[model samples]
Target chain A: MSLPELLRKISPTIWELPVTYKEGMRVPARIIASESLIGGMEAGVFDQAANVACLPGIIDYAWCMPDGHWGYGFPIGGVAAFDPDSGVISPGGIGFDINCGMRLCLTNLTEDEVRPRIRELVDQLFFAIPTGVGCTGFVRCSRSTFRRVIENGSRWCLENGYALPEDLEMTEEGGRFEGADADACSDKAVERGFDQIGTLGSGNHYCEIQVARPENIFDAATARAFGITIPNQVVIMFHCGSRGFGHQVATDYLQTFLKVMTTKYGIKLYDRELACAPFRSPEGQAYFAAMKCAANMGFANRQVILHRIREVFSRLFHRSPRDLGMDMVYDVAHNTAKLEKHIVHGVERELLVHRKGATRAFGPGMTGLPDRYRDSGQPVIIGGSMETGSYLLAGEASAAPTFYTTAHGSGRTLSRHQAKKMVQGRKLLDDMERRGIHVRTDSYGGLAEEAGLAYKDIDVVTRVTEDAGLSRRVAKLVPMGNIKG
Target chain B: MPYRFQDEITTADVAFEAWGDTREELFISCATALLRTMTAAPEQVAHEQKRVIRLKHEELDLLLFSFLQELIFHKDAHRLLLHADSVRIEQRESIFKLVATVSGEPIDAARHRLLVDVKAVTLHRFQVLFRDNQWRAVVELDV
Candidate 1:
């Protein structure tokens, strides 16, 4: 069967269209979705994915995660790998929010044990960890220290007493993109990132407590391997990135690359946002280096936030983070660019893989994994809106076809404005409260902007991801308390 | 629409957005909204200059993106408050082209207060469409 034909009844959750569906496409298109969720992909999302296939050296299929939605040049929740020799790195693939990813930290306490202290904890967190749109945090690093952050990522946090040595082992890419070039970053990107460390930049970035009830564990063996503790143990998970610092680096490089895409590399793009230079071109090399800086900043950002959370927990529970049994579970960046090896046409090929709005789901025993999780696949933290449930998943065998990637979140279904207009802030707050969800926000608008109704049904989305053989589920998590920046 | 500068976000409004009949107008409105959010109207004139820039978009979505970044370029380049005086969209066989003329004046503190630097335009929640017999562009920024 052809791609689109195979899509016809591939479990109400899958959709595929072959190269013949779109002229000039080098690879076919596959969409992991269910019927109800198909509307989310209605707005030129498939068209964007087809464009991705048309690129010079795309491999396998331009796969769209279940939460896929229309984005700049590539659909959000999109993943594609390009062969290094013939492939290109489109800024659109990694997104402007570099390393905007998730980190899950396990705690010893359960929902019943911490229910009473939730409010104070969130308040303390707000004070200790800066939030809001332009929020800055406690860390006041000098330029040299900022450079260290750019160079070392979470490692800098460990040296500065902000993270434990074990934390680095648990982070994807070991908390640092291995090939990052610190010197390639500009002074401005560094300046913007300095005070922003440990801060939770606003709009969809949040800190939440997920209740991992006994019944929610999907993979018992995998659950046991991750130190998730008992059935009722509570875990804290949050999503953020390098903040404006990362944004600046991506913006600066994107503009520079757009200016030279044709003149320097003879590369013509279907979209300017997809503007790219060759991987080794001066512009491309600079972007890759600068991109590493942003990725490191994100690692440091999450690491610092973890430290602040530790302080908050110690104060409320009268136990140190270690005593509370709080330890890093994993930190994985969904938006990133990395050079990894995968088999193409039955031959091992090095490819530049860009995963935007997607997470790396490297399977068990990848050498990069910490010893603690080597027997189990890397922990893939898939966060959903506060009202919905999230999942702890592991990469599956099928991931090898597309670089072990999966969807990021319950991708947006409503624009922020539409959400605010549709779900009034006061009502949304009341509804959440009525449902036993405790919510805090830097601005009520922020709350409204993230109204759970704005996103697709995460349950259905993740099921599709699993059904499609992208990532396998381990546990489901429901939020008890949330701090939205 | 006259620009309504939003700085102090009320519990009721998390962020602001703009709409227009043309992609250019929608982008200009968004640019004005972004500038208004960044700082108050120039109460004290800091400086002034004019910037001419170009934007090309293969999709209606990127056209809006290029237009917003053009405004960012002006804000960073001239250190002045800008208002798009005019905009024109020309479509080639494969791309939608934009030529805009904008004016900027020095920052007048009495009128301006920095709100948020729209770090960059995201492909997230970006849209350009024809609806209800009109062209409308919808976009959200990473503030």
Candidate 2:
């Protein structure tokens, strides 16, 4: 059904699809979009959100962020919280890139200091950081070390001489988790993760040189808090995740879950990708532990990549990364499951939250947050479609209705196959270059699939993510040079 | 036939694409391509195991994403370096099927190490197009 047909007017900004609208729907489906924006649903974006509403124990409405798009089970901009007792956790909802997220690094170098050196810097980074499909980085570890890496997450990076103490302090989750079991992961997943740590695998995973606004001049106090500097300063921002290991964990468990979903649990699913098992079941616990391992590996991956970026910059500039004032602003998880507390039925209840293709936007003073950030709300990062501007946002109290979540990216506007037919790889690169955006990747065919036109306008999406009270905008970043996977 | 590297449109400033005629062939070719990014997927495994996974439309895509994700998972999980032996895909009314038999032993110090793991198959520029009756799926997996 089309968007207009699917949505029911609830409030001026809120639209709902009642539970009776579809079989197996446990709760109503709500979308926060304007009429014209809802017209864009030929994309069938709301279908996934609708399927999400069918989930057992789903609380409130399974919401659709304005940038909503069709995805596996949960729509691209989906938000839902299931009851801990009866709720189910599905791997598809968390996506394969467990904790795949973005990191912003503020640099002391101003734009003028790097304009002439941009090309060389970009090239060096491209080389220093292995990218493109299957690109691996420099950390070669023994199996035991790899296990510790996964069990420890970003803390592993701190232990491995890759990050500073402050780096760990600034990262979301402090780069580690409370419950990760290395043994829960399969041998195959462990093998894939060992040496693959600290690499930027391709596809939307990128390391871009972003420029802070020239006139808007990122707020000094806020910039200082984030480690950013004066006007026209250059920063490196990138998004990536735990590579093969994480994928294996998700794949193995998804198959495992599908094998017993209807038979063992007696739970029916509207979508197979939403295949799930009880959160405390043997299979569920195993997947959760393994997923945690993948999440930690991802933390280590980003931590190690940060080290490489620092090394590359230091080598080229003949200065230390510290001297250059290169520091991590923050790292937030975009995918993963967490056990947390929320107000349910007007009573606080502990719950397992699965944020797939979404970000955690906890308001100030929530548990699970570090002490320093308790007052300012969780730092939320919203990655835009590559051709657009990505934003740094903070959670607002108004997001209580949203379970403190926000849109993950400027969600896809078109499928990759649809985009490739319209633009050739080389020509598309030339066009991006003509527009002053540097592009590099292993395959042009892959490049065509990722053209920015394939995604919704990020500016509008971020505005809604904020206007809806999910996450408020802090800063907008424009890309300069990028190393594609 | 050699796998061609595509340098087309910018793929999120990170990923790129490559394709081949057959599923097994693309597996081997993409393996070679990914290894070239760093090391290689190696050849001639001492043993092989075939697993068949059937899934619904949504799980099917996730299954496919996980299949490659598993290879990368194990490459990191058990440190096993594998070479693709075979891969076949079949579609049903409400189900899609995949059968892949891959081989390799645990990744050892003696074996060469290459690139990082490919996390999942991305929806970006992803398609399984059968043009001229040649079965070809062009997808850019997020590494």
Model number with the top lDDT: 1
Residue-pair clash count for candidate 1: 15
Q: What stretches of model 2 exceed 4 Å from their correct place?
A: A4-6, A216-224, B1-143
TM-score of each: 0.83, 0.81
**Where's the lowest-lDDT run of ten residues in candidate 2 chain A?**
A215-224
Report the Cα lDDT for residue A408, model 1. 87
Chain A TM-score per candidate? 0.96, 0.95
Model 2 interface CAPRI class? incorrect
DockQ, every prediction: 0.14, 0.18
User: Which 10-residue window in model 1 chain A sums to the lowest lDDT?
Assistant: A1-10
**Residue-wise C-alpha lDDT for candidate 2, range A236-269, written one tens digit per residue:** 8889888877876886787788778899999886
Q: Model 2, residue A263: what's the lDDT? A: 92
Candidate 1 structure quality by residue, lDDT tens digits, A23-126: 78898887778777775455467777888888777888888888887666678888888877777877778887799999999988988888787778777876
CAPRI grade, predicted model 1: incorrect
